[model samples]
Target: MAKQKIRKGDLVQVIAGKDKGLQGKVIQSLPRDGKVIVEGVNRVKKHTKVGQTARGSQTGGIITTEAPIQVSNVMLVVEHEGKKVVTRVGFRREEQERTLPDGSKKTVTRSVRFAKKTGEAI
Candidate 1:
């Protein structure tokens, strides 16, 4: 499996589906399923039977929440030139020097995500 680009708390815009053009923050990421739950998008109503909790408190009722949507349906939103815009994600590997416990500096390579539209780190 490839790495997941979209992450929790990332602002994204729905590019396809009934919620097209809607923007929201990603609440969760499901990399294995290639899905993400966005706040205020793909709202779903769930019905539940009345039940008692371990604390003896009421626990079930009609609930509304965001449902998972395919990661492809959304695009990451970034601010560009004082305007909000959607951009594709790109990964880049960079080398940096790190100091080891032995006081020796070592070069390490790390992957980073960046905005393809503006060529800027994200």
Candidate 2:
């Protein structure tokens, strides 16, 4: 399994491939395949034959929809200083001392995703 940083509903920009430079919100994330489906990106046309659905008889023709793009090919977008910018994501872990019910102190580490360029939490 691949570690997934980009997730569904995240605004991302295509960093490579045929759709390079296009930005869109993530519609789905396939962590198992390290791929994500972004809205309005990677559009592909599919020809379909006549078919019937539970709703009723469906009209089928050339349908355009989004296709999956590799997770590594997209970068998350964030607002920085009034401008939308793309940045690499970095994880920051901080340990805090917490007092248990028995009065014993324990350290707990929390993980956060931040933009590497601006150091802003996302």
Best by TM-score: 1
Instruction: Provide the lowest-lDDT 10-residue window in model 2.
Output: 1-10
The residue pairs in collision within model 1 are none
Task: Give stretches of model 1 more than 4 Å off.
Answer: none
Question: Candidate 1, residues 1-122: lDDT per residue as tens digits?
Answer: 98889999999999999999999999999999999999999999999999998999988789998899999999999999999989999999989899999999999999989999998888
Candidate 2 residue-wise lDDT at 101 = 100
TM-score of 2: 0.83
Estimate, for each residue in 9-115, the C-alpha lDDT of model 2 and write its tens digit. Answer: 89999999999999999999999889999999999999999888898978789999999999999999999999999998889997889999999999999888899
RMSD of each: 1.5, 2.9
